[model samples]
Target: MKRELKVTSDGSKTLYMENWDECYHSVHGALNESMHVFIKNGLNEVEADSLHILEFGFGTGLNALLTLSERGGRSIQYTALEKYPLSEEEWNAVAYGRTSEERVAFASIHLADWNAPVEIESGFVLKKVETGFEEVEFEPNSVDLIYYDAFAPSAQPELWTTELFTKCFQTLKPGGFLVTYCAKGQVKRNMKEVGFEVMALPGPPMKREMTKATKPSNV
Candidate 1:
C-alpha cells in the first residue's frame, strides 16, 4: 500500500492510502476529527476517576496522543490493537503535538513495546497489542470505553459487522460506550442488535454524523 502525506483543512497532516483510497484521519482536519470524535464525544462523556480504554485501530496514534493530553488527571489504561503497525517514517509524518509534553508523549506512544504494558507517563499506562482485534479475546465487561476508529465500512466491511460490534458490547463495562466517526445506518443497527444504545451525533468538519454506542449500566 502506497502512503502519501497530505495536509488537512486545519493544516494538520494525514496519511492517504492509495490502495484503499482512505485516509488515516479525516481530510477535513486530522486534529479536529480526533478531538471531536474521540475526545469530545467519547472520552469526555464518561465520568470516571480511572479509565480502561480500548482502541480498535492504532493507526497514526493521534487518538492516543490526544487522550493522554486531555485525560484531566484521571488514571488511564489505554490498550490499542493494531494489525499492521506503522513504520517510524509513517508515524512521524503526521503533524501533531505542538507543545513539548505532547511531542514527548506522541513519540512514546509510537516507541512503546508491543504485547506488553508500558507506562508512557504518570497515571497513563499504554499497552500496544500487535494483533487484529478479532483474534484477541478481551475479558468481558472490563473495558470502560472503546475508540472504534477502524477504517470505513466500505474499505473493510467485515470490521463493521454485527459479530464485531457484539464483541465490543461484550467487552465494555456496564455504562461504558464505544465512539467512532462512523454513522452508517447498518452499523448503528448492528450495534443495537448487540444491545448497545446508539446515538447519532453531529460529525466533525467533513462529516455529517458520527456514532456513539453505549452499553447500559443495568445490563
Candidate 2:
C-alpha cells in the first residue's frame, strides 16, 4: 500500500509505511539537496567521461532526475535499488510544481522501464533494480558514487549496520564518495569499520548535520 506523507512546511509528498518514512526530497526540495550533495560534492569531482552511480532507495526518482539534468559532459550509468516501488499513478501525483525544466526531467525518470536500462537522454542511462538493498549485487570497485538515502536507523536498522556498509564499501572504487542525510554515531562507526573516512557536514534546514564517507585509494 502507498500513502502520501506531509514533509516539511511546504507540504511536499513523502512516502510512508506504518513507521518508516522515505525520501525527504519532497519536503526538502528534491533538486536543491541533490545538487548540494551529489553534484557539488560527489559527481563534479569524478573526472571520468563515464561514471557509474548506485542509489540505495530510489524514491520518487528525484536524485535520478536531478543527476540527468546536470550531466553535461559525461555519460552516467545509474542504477537504483527499490524494493516496494511506487506505482506509476502514485509517482504522477507528486507535484514537481512550476519548475518546468526540472519537471520535464523528472517526468522522464518514471516513464523508464524497470530492470531494462533506458537512456532518458544523451549521456544518461538509468536502470531500476526492483530488489531490496541486501539482495542487490554490485561489482567491486566499480561505482563512482553511492547515494545512501535509506530511511533512518530507527526505522530500518539493517540498512545502517556494519554489514551493509561493508557491502557498500566493496562496491565503490577508491576515492568514491558515499553521501547520506544520516549522521548517527553508529552509522559513522560502521562506515569507519568498513574502511571509509567519514566527514560530518552541515545539513539542510531543520537538520543539524549529514555524513559523507570516502573510500581510500589503497582500500
Local distance difference test, per candidate? 0.93, 0.80
Tens-digit lDDT track for model 2 on 81-181? 99888877777776553479777767878878899899888888899989999997788899999999887788789889898999999999998989987
For candidate 1, report its TM-score: 0.98
Which regions of candidate 2 deviate over 4 angstroms? 5-7, 10-12, 21-31
RMSD of each: 0.9, 2.2
Model 2, residue 145: distance off in Å is: 0.4
Residue 108 C-alpha lDDT in model 1: 92
Quote the lDDT for 133 in model 2.
95
- Top candidate (TM-score): 1
